[model samples]
Target chain A: MSGAVEIAGVGLHRFGRFDGTSVVDLGLVAVRAALADAGLRRGGFQAAYCGTVYSGVAAGHKVLTALGLTGVPIVNVEAGCASGAAALDLGVGAIRSGRYDCVLVFGMEKMPAGIIRSSFFEPWREEAGLAVTPAYFALRAQRLMRESGVTREMLADVSVKNHRNGVHNPDAMFRKEFSVEQVLSSALVCDPLTLFMMCSPNEGAAAVVLRRGGRGGVEIAASALRSHLPGSVLGEHTPLSGLIDDTAPPPTSLAARAAFEEAGLGPGDLDLCEVQDTDSARELNSYEELGLCGVGEAGPYYAAGHTQMGGALPVNASGGLLSKGEPLGASALGGIVELYRQLRGEAGARQVDGARVGLAHTVGRGANASVVILKR
Target chain B: MSASRPVRDGLFRDCGDGTARLLGARCADCARYHFPRAEVCPYCSCDSCSAADLGPRGRLWLYTAVLRPPPGYRGVVPFGFGVVDLEEGVRIVARLTEGDPARLRSGQPMLLVVEHLHDDDGTRVETYAFAAAEEG
Candidate 1:
């Protein structure tokens, strides 16, 4: 595609909890690093987009002005966990539309310590004890296990793998590994899903610089986002309003299909990937949704170790959201930053060798899903 | 006498006798039902929808027990959250009277009941829930 945009530079302020660091501080670090990496000053960009959920209005404007990079259009985007990817889509769109040659995109968030307070559900639901994010994940896990014969052991294995990989990722919040036995025995957040199996809400920031036409950096072949369809009930906090259609395609599957078609590539052509592993069971479920494996096959697929760093298709090489607690708006952008490092062979100990094409997927509480494909 | 109130009005109505029934919105165009009522049809987006009494009967579809209560929740910690598929083709999310996760099973028959969610300064906030149906 002639309109394909290239990722000129990527930067990240390590994913973790910074007790005293303001959201703007984390964002400034990432933005300056990205601009420096791109060999351009902050004033060179035509526009700016910031992705965040909890941060208040004009978050982008505040972040840009702190660096004296003002007088440009700044748009703030919020799509639950996919906020970062949605903002990246805007940057890519602007560049491809010939509106501007270079655009800056940054995603940052400082989340509260306990369970995520999602206002997406009515207050009654929250009072009824149905608003916990992990509760929905556990419900999906129970159904998937009943349908696929997947065991809790298999789910723990996903955590074991991702956490072990996290040890190599200095940017990951939790850089410690846990055994399968340790995972299954961890604190139970919900039935069949343990505390460590789920990603906690925390702080972090990731930024990327995009250019209309570039020769060196990774090319963004496809950047697609899709929201939940009517009659769809699969999301973090969506109310169960319409008739339940168990067979309807979820937003992630739809977005992935669109990205693959746009990129002229299929799952088999991908060398590695970074997906929304908000929880371990989610990673297994995503294997089916992303076409990495068939339905009811992710359990066996993980047990066989096919998704490790050296496996057939390594996923979450940056240790995933499970290792780096989700910073709502910055979650998806973190995956893209990881993919950029992987494509450039700069992932240090977690590098996936000869990785040419990588895909990043993130789904949010608003029932929005984004899939972006990058090729070296 | 203290008044018994539904958490959200129009969600259900008391028969003035001792029993209450759920209020669902039925679409005249698409023949689908919505729980907790709706102004417009969610399926067909048609305004041809009206409130109807959804008799309290459905089968359990999926469920999980919350180990900890969420903010603003005064219900017992570790309460069961479930979805019951009513005969009207709509799935409603509600708390299960069955607190134990192991006792709950998909496809089990269920019946609705109104219980106290929390006390707001001596005012009992009544909310609807589903329990394992008694065998006939």
Candidate 2:
């Protein structure tokens, strides 16, 4: 492709929870996998961007220190769930600006099991019992269900559809699926959101090495980032990075529009995609924001099963975060790994045949969105 | 009598006009303003920011009800929080004073009422929160 940043290789440690594994171990395995795939050494990278949600600063140093004096600078990036794409964007920007010939981008996370805490909320608000992310999204979902006439079953349908797709994805967290009745009947995390509707957070890591695009190439056309709608930071810790827990047009749409422009293509031209499927409803909303179809058409698209592996632009063939499990930091990068496989026709049983173009979008805390376009 | 956490808690002031407001900041360089008191002059990066009070009343933009308790927030499941776009053009996130998520709606008008958050070490940590503004 013209004016694109080439993806030399992508590596992923198995996308399962690393409850027993350390973050650096996951990093080494994934980095080795990527390095081997790229036909390069760890020394090949001039700079590195490591993204993680739970792991704080010096995380990149913790990982790179194992590789020895590569002399490459490492920066730790944390953008909630969208950490991978955000870090990749920085690395890609560095390469596109001609500052570095090759940059390595990686995301890894070992989230505290059970409920997570993103410290972008005010202490007072938290005391008022307004800190959990699932609660916030659940509120929105409840409202959307009321306003959109979307049913709990419809939401489950989204999960089932993605889980079915994930059955074909070896890297997904949940390999099996349950009937809509089961999804509806499952235990509730919130009133309408059941265990099935909500994707479980896992421990995982993903890596990609990038250089300038060349012949026989699969390159990054663009990765666009948008600031989330503003929120009260008086006591910031709002989960999901800038939505600030309660107020504005999620800045995600801006990223979608910008990604389209930057890639010199529109959503209609897309062949395949992987988006943040943290929940069934969010994925449906994303189908609209990604411009895959019209507004409020996610129910129809999902009901008609248009997003299946062979449908009009296979969406989330990697089982998405729903089936694959939401590892937050590694979640978006996992999307990249899946897209790369699609473009290379190496997806084997799940490959979208002759896939020439694809996009991967990941959203983070406070409404930060990152869109990455790829072409073979 | 009992110790269940209040949905929200904050100091209240009588406006003498029946109006109470959330605190905020106004920028001197660009006339831009923020709620919860803007610190860094997000508009022009100028160091001049002045504190002021903003409407506790505003339109509900979007909201969520987190069913799970986050790490720091200790409360029962299913908490409602939404973006209240204040009349002053600053949007701040606060717990929907209406503990009932079922009653909340998008674009619905709301007024802020300071309330209690939780008790600290058996003592009240009294902090800022909102209640569904009383309709006139």
Candidate 3:
């Protein structure tokens, strides 16, 4: 890949709930660490792409200003969980378009309680009470249970497995393990989805420095993003339409195809994968959409441990947002940070030995999706 | 159970004072029109985007009554959430007013009307809302 933009370095601070630190503060720690990892002077970047949702206006500048980096162009991006991926895309676009050789991409967020009010949702909706993330996931879970033989205990198992993986991740916020029964009994957020199955919002920052003309730790094979438009194939808010496919071949399958085509790679080429497992059912949904297994087959595959490390496909080996704890904008890049560690052969316990290629998929509440493919 | 808020009126108070509406934003340039008044324009990204009133006319997309909500939001129990597709082509999600849910369905029509969204006290506080309606 002669023209491929490379990730020179990636950095992340310990993932945890921040009661005193601001979003901008967490961003600085990660950015500084990434800059050091790349062995590149922070002053060498031409532009900055900052992804955040709840940090408020000039959120990027607020973080960059703390770094004393000025006069550089800064663009704030927000696309829910896809924000970091979207921001990284912007940096890559700039480098590939010949606008700049190097760019800084990162996502920082500090989640607030009581529904995590999405900056995109209109206030009228919140007042009216239509924007519940768990309920939305629960709707999908309920439907999936109705169609598939998967039960709540099965969903609890997903959390159990992920929490086990989380124990291997030193920086994860909630590293304590849980049993299936424990997960099943956790507080209920939405019907059919327990507090354990649903990712809890927290604060953190993940940054990946990208360079155009230089060799790097990993190569970004391909990246893709899409939005759900009305009248489009199975728009989420539009009930008149159904998913693009019912039997199999999830909408994410299309995105995966495009990413692989762009990178000249395929699913069989991957060594490990990280999917948007905001809700446990969502992880099962990803299994089908990502072509890891057939539709309605994820429950069994997961139960049989096909997704665990050393399995056919080691998924969320770094303790996915589900296990690592949720950090909104930073979660996707956090997954990237995990894949980076795996590819570099630096992963300690949950490492997929000899892994060469990795993919990270992120989806937002607005029904937005993004896929990023990286290689050693 | 979150804090109880007094009934608010006139479309949107959850965001801020009268400076913002449930849907209203001025185009910084050309000043054509926009709703959920954006920080910039759907046509262009400019800080000049001013507040523009969104005249009524829209329809419902989908809705469901929630027996419970995640912690934080304090409102009446058993409320409904629905999607509204404005005539301008932008679709938004909102709370469905008190109505026969049997009247709700996919692609069911709707229109914009001012009504008391919730009551913090006995006095009704109004907010812009979407009420299901006929196609015409």
What is candidate 1's lDDT per residue for A1-376, written digit by digit as tens? 4676998888899989899899999998889888988887646999999999989988888889989999989999999889999999999999989899999999999999878777786887777666777777887788778876578988888888888888999999999999989999999888889987888889999999999866767999899999876675545546654565546678889999999999999999999999999998888888888888887787777777789979999989889988988998888999999999899989999999999999999987878899999998
For model 1, chain A alone compared with the true chain A gives a TM-score of: 0.97
Candidate 2 docking: what grade?
acceptable
Residues A1-376 of candidate 3: C-alpha lDDT, one tens digit per residue = 4567988788897778878888888999888888888876456788888888788898888877887886889999988778888898889888888888888888888886445666454554455554465556665675557555678898888778788889989888778789989998887665577878987788899998888844655888898876653233222332212211123233466667678888888778889999888889888877777777776677677777778877878888888887776677788889888888899999998889899999998877556677889897
Candidate 2, TM-score vs. the true structure?
0.84
Q: Per-residue lDDT for B1-136 in model 2, tens only?
A: 6453333332234354544666567888867666545567654578889987777577776665555566676655555666666667666666665655578766787876644445667754433445565456
Best by DockQ: 1
Chain A only: list TM-scores of all candidates: 0.97, 0.92, 0.92
Candidate ranking (TM-score, best to worst): 1, 2, 3
Q: Model 2, stretches more than 4 Å misplaced?
A: A1-3, A146-149, A229-249, B1-20, B25-34, B39-68, B75-92, B97-114, B127-136
List where candidate 3 sits over 4 angstroms from the true fold.
A213-216, A231-251, B1-67, B70-136
A209, model 1: CA deviation in Å? 0.2
Show the lowest summed lDDT stretch of 10 residues, model 3 chain B.
B11-20
- Root-mean-square deviation per candidate: 1.6, 4.4, 8.2
Q: How high a TM-score does candidate 3 get? A: 0.75
List native contact recovery per candidate, as a fraction of 1. Answer: 0.73, 0.37, 0.15
lDDT of 2 at B98: 64
TM-score (0 to 1) of chain B, per candidate?
Answer: 0.89, 0.75, 0.61
Interface RMS for model 2: 5.5
The better candidate by TM-score, 1 or 2, is 1
